[model samples]
Target: MSVLSATDVRRNWSQFNDDIVREGPQFVKRNRDEWVAMSTEQLKAAFSNFTFHAHLVQEDDGTITATLDQFDLVENGSSEKEVLEALTYELIEYSQEYMENFKLYFHSPNRKAHFPYILNVVAQDHPENVRQLITCQAGVK
Candidate 1:
């Protein structure tokens, strides 16, 4: 991963974009915080390859809404912490169910032939996600 200051990014915006286009991702720092810059293809591949990003939004009704858009999943709570915890449990439950169905269908020769390669691609990019899904499916805490 490449790291650059905020000023460096502003001064060399073209070069930075070029680098991300050729390379992958880069980190830019602004004051105490840092942000990542990646191409759309990179972001799409990351999300489609078993990675997830959760976003929290505050509503006018005094509730916090947490959303993981990749799966079209949403959870609401009174506080940010509550919503996040809910999202975690929801993801685990959903993954377990998905794995259960996948395992059942995988017994078929056609399904077995096609799905494993896709899963293998995801596993190659995000082994942790694959492991977590299988582990969650096993009903392990």
Candidate 2:
């Protein structure tokens, strides 16, 4: 791995972009902070997923628009509590990386209609879980 100062990164952004395109990815530092990485593949994958979500709901702005109609219908349509509990359990069972990606999915600029609903379900009855998620989002350990 390579570390770079923010100034070096800013001063040579084009070079960095070329590196990302030529190589797989490149590490970028900003203000002496290990802020994030630059990767053509990673960005492409993220945006592609976002596009898939947009297509699911016919949104042109590239945001998620997951209406209740998008979810699987219950046999008799249960209460939100039951649905939330089920989803929370699934989230807890999945790896932390999955949950982190989920957070990103929800916070996309082109947010899905049901994105908030999904987050609410995942956060319910799990304050610690929610905090952990926030920590991950803030890039804190």
- Considering every candidate listed, which one attains the maximal TM-score? 1
Q: Tens digits of per-residue lDDT for model 2 on 1-141? A: 777777887889888778777775666666556665645355544433221110123234433222223333211113333333433344444323335677675565654444544434343345444322221111111
Least accurate 10 contiguous residues by lDDT in model 2: 132-141
Query: How accurate locally is residue 69 in candidate 1, as Cα lDDT from 0 to 100?
Result: 45
- After TM-score superposition, the amount by which residue 115's alpha carbon in candidate 1 deviates from its true location, in angstroms, is 8.9
Q: Judged by lDDT against the true structure, how good is candidate 2? A: 0.42
Listed in order, each prediction's TM-score against the native is 0.40, 0.31
Off by over 4 Å in 1: 1-50, 103-141
Please give the CA lDDT of all the candidate structures. 0.62, 0.42
Let me know the TM-score candidate 1 reaches against the reference structure: 0.40
lDDT of 2 at 52: 10
Tens-digit lDDT track of model 1 for 101-126: 88665675544543422343333334
